[model samples]
Target: MAGTLQFDLVSPERRLASVVASEVQIPGADGDLTAMEGHAPTITTLRPGVLKVVSTEGAKSYVVTGGFAEISATSVSVLAERAVPVEELNATLMDQLIADASEATAVAVDKDAADKAMADLVAMRAAAGF
Candidate 1:
């Protein structure tokens, strides 16, 4: 098998990452999917969770809110709703965000709106590991 695959991670704001990695684990719709060089071409929807990339240097993790991943034989591209490096995550900020989302959801008159807010808050908390 080949040693590495080219990887790109993009968000609505900008391209968050571009690198070559030996392996990557993504939060797929069904579950976590691991990819490596020479993998078959496919596309998968991603959930809000941690994406782990492994290289000769080491493993790095990123928090992805939502997106789709395109996997080719030699490349993988992820277009995310929101993408952030794990190193940049702040527990305090996440806590505040969760509280705000919760408060808004609690007073929301529309059930669907409240559900979406709750889901968003849960996803953010999950991605942040809080």
Candidate 2:
């Protein structure tokens, strides 16, 4: 743990990942950023994209819709609106997500909200390589 940092990824439903990692790549709202053990303290909003975690166990990836991340010298914590392990995602799931997003967009109360939802889904699809 000498060169590693504690990283936690939490969705509204549960904690997705909590482990010591050498590096974490987050899809920040403004852009993507990587955090290491000695990184400076910072906070950022997330966009729809993939999050990469690198540890002794090797690398794992998750797809996040939106969230906020708090970074410190010793840890990085993410509170995600929606997060799913990339390995668990499949074409069927992606199609379902897209359909759901389309429905939500169609029934959205406002244009801005609909746009955001659609954009998030689109990003998710692209990230999933579909």
Candidate 3:
């Protein structure tokens, strides 16, 4: 059996998850990465995409608009700007998020990054069937 690491996902709204997970798939700003037990110590910025986790209970997913992830050999902690369980994502909510992203993009300092994030959100919405 694979080793498990303590994984926690939090947002300004609430703590969405705390579990012993075998793997965590992060939507990193630079790229996507999967963290497992005994992984390297590092931190990564998140982008708008689906975050996946596999644990003893089952596989779960979350939608994170942006955030920072702190990874260590024994743990992975995600502090999200906005986070929602994938199951809870609906068309109304997705539309709101897209509108928000569009506004953010207009005023963003880094236009390229904002554009990328907006693209990611669109892709996520499509994947969610919205």
| Best model per TM-score | 3
- Candidate 3's error at 11, in angstroms? 0.7
Per-residue alpha-carbon lDDT of candidate 3 for residues 1-130, written as tens digits (9 for 90 to 100): 4799999999999999999999999999888999999999989999788899999999999988888999999999999989999999899999988888788788988788889999999998898899
Q: Poorest 10 consecutive residues of model 3 by lDDT?
A: 96-105
Candidate No. with top lDDT: 3
Q: Return the TM-score for candidate 2, rounded to 2 decimals.
A: 0.77
TM-score of each: 0.72, 0.77, 0.93
lDDT of each: 0.77, 0.84, 0.92
lDDT of 1 by residue, 12-123 (tens): 9888778889998998765679999889998998755678888766888887766799999898999987777878778876666456556755776666745654575577
| Candidate 3 Cα deviation (angstroms), residue 37 | 1.0
**Poorest stretch of ten by lDDT in candidate 2:** 108-117
In candidate 2, which residue pairs get closer than 3 Å at backbone N, Cα or C atoms, i.e. clash? none
Estimate the lDDT of model 1.
0.77
* CA lDDT, candidate 1, residue 73: 83
TM-score (C-alpha) between model 1 and the true structure: 0.72
